[model samples]
Target: MKQFTSIAALTGLISLANAHGFVTSPTARMPGDAMASACGQQVEVNQQSDNYGNIQGELQVASGQSDYSASECDIWLCKGYKFADNKDNVYSYTAGQTVDFTVDIRAPHTGVANVSVVETSSNSVIGSPLISWSVYASTATGVTANETDFSVTMPDDLGSKCSTAGDCVLQWYWYAESIDQTYESCVDFTLGGSGSSSGSGSGSSSSSSSSSSSSTAKAETTPAAVETTSAAVETTAAAAETTTAAPVETTPAAPVQYATTTFATQARQSAEPSVEVQTASAVETTGSSVVSTKPIPTDGTAQEKLNFVESILKYLAN
Candidate 1:
């Protein structure tokens, strides 16, 4: 039972470390996904990503050997791990067409991906790979999820290489920012259609005319002509910082309590309608000493004086 528990714990840890992800679009002979149509053999994934390992920095700039090291081919992702059948033109793409590069994410991470095309003849990535055209380059800012999609317009210039080389390779290198890890994928394919031809590869004369006009306009407006003087900039900055601040901390004086006997005085005055009663400021006590300093009525009958005393007392209590 103890041995069984240890084995189970080890298995759980392996499962966590083996969390994987890869490009699921442009169909690059992924594991378990049938590749008999494009590849030579059946590709299987023992680990989520097979022997493909982690790498650091931008793929185009990063220097090191991955699990799929280049003893076989740097352009070919997964190196010797992939099947022997993957060395052929899998699909063809038209130049200048907007393509969506999609990736399946199980173990989502943060990073950017660079998708580019290169000549398969060289199969070399040192210095600069034979990526005749850099299709798209961008950072993965908000990418964390089930699928990451990058819409990139393919470059029209194949630079006379594809004219004779026949086919090219598309490679997507995904590098994780938080860790020293990188995901690499490649698809063997050919370039054809509208933009692939050398004749049409160069843009139309109208585009070139527009580009020339833009350059001339830029040349006309030199930096010295539009520069702001340092003294004027300093003055503006000084004016912005010249702020008059209101007091932040203030101490309001505590309120004073003045002795008020308006209600008692009013009650005393009201009692005078029936009997002559003194005001609150000048009052005299009568009958019981317990009701000290009360405004009692003078020259009043016993019942009238008693009523006046009760009325004043009620107001005074309130």
Candidate 2:
């Protein structure tokens, strides 16, 4: 029993030496009964002794324990910290709110790190990371001011995804790739309010675009309607001109033909009356006496007719 106790103490010391970092501010989740039931009592006790230890060390302790259930523990996420144990420590935040973070680095190991909003149930990142560092806490370069002290702004887009206390967490993830060690600490948070101003801005843009499109449609339709009406008006005017031209052409033709026939008949009648008067007075002309005579029929040329009338006029004068 004494030998076993000695070995255990030495193993604990080794694990502590290997562990590098943990979140110091904002009261990160700690091991409790809920964690022990899922991760095995030994693994829970191991973390209770040194909560700053890495996930690799916890897995080492869990390997020999029959009670550890990997599926239930989900140690890869937040080092299997249970929300039930940290219920009282949950944070309430509004969208676009900024939160300050402080991490204590007991030992330096060059690594990559990020802080993100994570959904607790599915272990999925809610969105892009709030902040990240490609190189962090290098042994040679040492930890920097930005690495240990920083702030992350809550996302504007998470409307109700994190309204409940246990639904989500602000997770700090650090992986020392060279050493193959990973450490995680989670801060429980519940978002308040409907959403952020950015969401409202997007909606306003959509409405403006819709209004502009509608105006454009109306503007296009008006020109087409005017063009159609103009075309119809031009067609009607052309048809009216064509209809009026037909009556003018037909009416003039009939009047010209009738006038020509009437003028010829009057000329013939006048010539006959003069011929009759001259013939009737031809035998009685010497002694101032008058005699009636019938007009003779003649189909003479135009000059002959003129000569015949002139001869009669001279005889009547004598």
TM-score, per-candidate, Cα-based = 0.38, 0.59
**Model 2 ranges off by over 4 Å:** 1-11, 194-318
Clashes of each: 2, 2
Cα deviation at 210, candidate 2, in Å, is 39
Once superposed on the true structure, which residue ranges of model 1 sit more than 4 Å away at CA?
Answer: 1-16, 31-70, 73-84, 87-89, 121-147, 163-167, 193-318
lDDT of 2 by residue, 168-195 (tens): 8889999988688899999876666533
Q: Please list the C-alpha lDDT of all candidates, in the order they appear.
A: 0.40, 0.69
Position 155, candidate 2: lDDT? 82
